[model samples]
Target chain A: MKPNNPLKKEKIWRVAAVLFWLAAWQGGAMLLNDSLLLVPPARVLQRFFALVREKSFYSAVLFSLARNAGGFALGLAAGVLLAALAARARPVEYLLRPLMVAVKSIPVASFIILALVWLSGRRVSVFIVFLMVAPIVYGNLLAGIKSESVQLREMGEMYRVPWPDRVLYIELPQLKPHLMSALSLSLGLSWKSGVAAEIIGVPRGSMGYALYQAKLYLDTPSLYAWTLTVVLLSVLFERFVLWTVKRAYARLERL
Target chain B: MTRLIDICKAFDGKPVLEHVTLSLAPGVTCLMGVSGRGKTTLLRILTGLETPDSGTVEDRPGRIAVQFQEDRLVESLTVGRNLQLALGRAYDAGKAESCLASLGLPGCLQLTVSTLSGGMKRRVSLARALLYPAPLLVLDEPFQGLDADTRGAAIAAVRRGAEGRAALVVTHEAKDCELLGGRLITL
Candidate 1:
């Protein structure tokens, strides 16, 4: 038999904590005696498993995942590129400052409604998710670039290190923490805003549309199931992305 | 040879270095001074990292390598990685290992820079600068955290690496100048 590791212990605690919450939910549902208002955890799980057996559920999950992933990748790329440009040029920074501020200050619902008017329901979520993620990534990366190691940069200059090598070796390593933070925060945010946009837009074949249907039919178990799916998918996706980035960083450091 | 003539620098209306003239040739030259006397500023100017108020640098090399007053090693990287970043395509693994061995840091190439002691970090920084392919080398307080025996060995390694190259060293210790057999220039 293999010995226990801290990771296994951590997983056990996480599962226990989740089970504890589920038990409390079940107890509350039992006391209230109203499945309409609050469904038990077992009912939610049963509905979720049944959902997995349906074709529409699979289609909705795929649709929502694709849109969210696409918007996130686009925003990440644009934010990183803009941040690099802004860090190097003062005029670019000045040009972007007010736009980023306005994006940050405006409400997400406002953006969704405005985008819905200008774009189709299919594109509205993509646009909303992009708007939600870009500013955060840009801000965090700009801070990281601005606060990059001047000592290391100077060392690179002294050694005549090429600009590409300096960025790869010195700047990126320093920016890893900030990039990871931006990714984690923005990933959750993109999912929230993207799903919210879908719910409001009620696009066909989307998880959000399924949620709206559940609400309209007063299916509390399905509501809880769909919400649980969203949360679980979001968490799992975040873990996978962070793990990939960490591995990439480790490999780059070796180079 | 790299020559500095009538170099002056000030920070926030306070003079750090004033009318300093010095010349470096293919040998070790030590700049000795107390703290805050602009020894570091002079080295920075020589390396073209800082601009002097009004002066001309004669016969400056096209490329220069420097170890700043701070060790300035990237804490996130390993020792070999740091050296490789500096040396780039010119890095020779065998030479690098021998150089580290000479400074009493054998088998430390893969250890991350953050895990190293202050003395070890200092030597690593020096080794990185020394490994870079440049005709001119500038080091500021390169022996700050080293013990007496390690300092002697480090000085010997530096002297060996600096052969036939114009090297400028900054320090406050008189014995360091003697150990390096360097020509003294008091600032």
Candidate 2:
């Protein structure tokens, strides 16, 4: 007989692992014997279905999603622009070094609290998310730009390759892995920091606010449901963004 | 008539090229040397990528086509796109295809450089140099990885490409100079 497909086997193993975890969670919840302390996975799923039927749930999801996405876009643009400037000029890199270090080292909770004091609750999540994302992108891309091959650059110079062509053909290919890494790292952090800021700020009509309400009422099932919703949304957003970028790279390679 | 007069270059106080004077005319000139003989440094100086510690370069061409020792190709891109990147508006698909075919890389325009074998990538790099329109051509170890027959074919192609232009080629083999029917300059 022919060997089994590795990809299919891997998929089956992954599914089995997930089922095993669910069973463990169910067992742990039963042993606890307190719904408030540990709601079972089945109850949480039921609660999630019921919560999804509410119009307020959609509003909350949309509100959090928009703020996180906006903050991520702003961070991405600023990081790329700063990285380009830093790559071109040594002084710019030095000037940004301290700021980037500070941003990377500072605590997310501290930034969220500072943002809350400076801005309204409605805007805190966006600010926090931006702060979380910019430094990661800037640092990774700067390294990528610095690591571009000297030999290839000399080849471009010798041939008098135009500025646009040099960037498209030489620089972009070298930077793709760095760019993807920055995106993957910053995207997950954006969601985490964005939701943390929202919960602290307790912005109305947001997932964070819904989570806070669930906590305030000591409703374990509702809290689990909202948490699951945020995770699903985050995962879907990451997949979509990564897929779009990969497709664009594929198109460029074809060209 | 490009000339290097009394050129001297050193790295960390060790001399690489000292008081080297040479002239390049409109024909193929094959440069032969052992390893660590500063052949690449001379090419770099001629191409203005490195400024000699002491020398005067006269009438250097503003544009030159160079094939560096390494196949400095964009690994993610297709062969045609690499040619297009270097040649810009001067790129002709028909000319490029035929040039690649002549270099023994037929039907390789659509293949990504990363997928190609070492010899194939070398030819692709050579094809880029040949296709680029310039007054001077500089190739460093252009026939490094080719077999004997392929090397002969590549030599013929390089000679044809060097017509009406100055070609500076660095190679280890004295036979390459005889094959190209060019003057020999040893560093």
> What does each candidate score in C-alpha RMSD?
2.4, 1.4
A1-255 per-residue lDDT for model 1 (tens digits): 653998988988999998998889899999999999889888989999999999888889999988988898888888999999999998999999999999999999999999989988887788888888899999999999999988889888877778988888889989998999999899999999999999888999999898999999998899999999899889987898889999999898776
**Which one wins on DockQ?**
2
Poorest 10 consecutive residues by lDDT, candidate 1 chain B: B172-181
Pairing residues by index, what is the TM-score of model 2? 0.97
Candidate 1 wrongly placed segments (more than 4 Å): A1-16
Off by over 4 Å in 2: A1-3
* lDDT value for model 1: 0.89
Docking class of 2: high
> Docking quality tier of candidate 1?
medium
Q: After superposition, how far is residue A134 of candidate 1 from its true place, in Å?
A: 0.7
Instruction: Tell me the lDDT of model 1 at A237.
Output: 79
All models, DockQ values?
Answer: 0.75, 0.91
Residue range B56-166, candidate 1, lDDT tens digits: 799988888788889888888889888888888988888888889899899999999999999999998889888878898888998888999899989998888788898
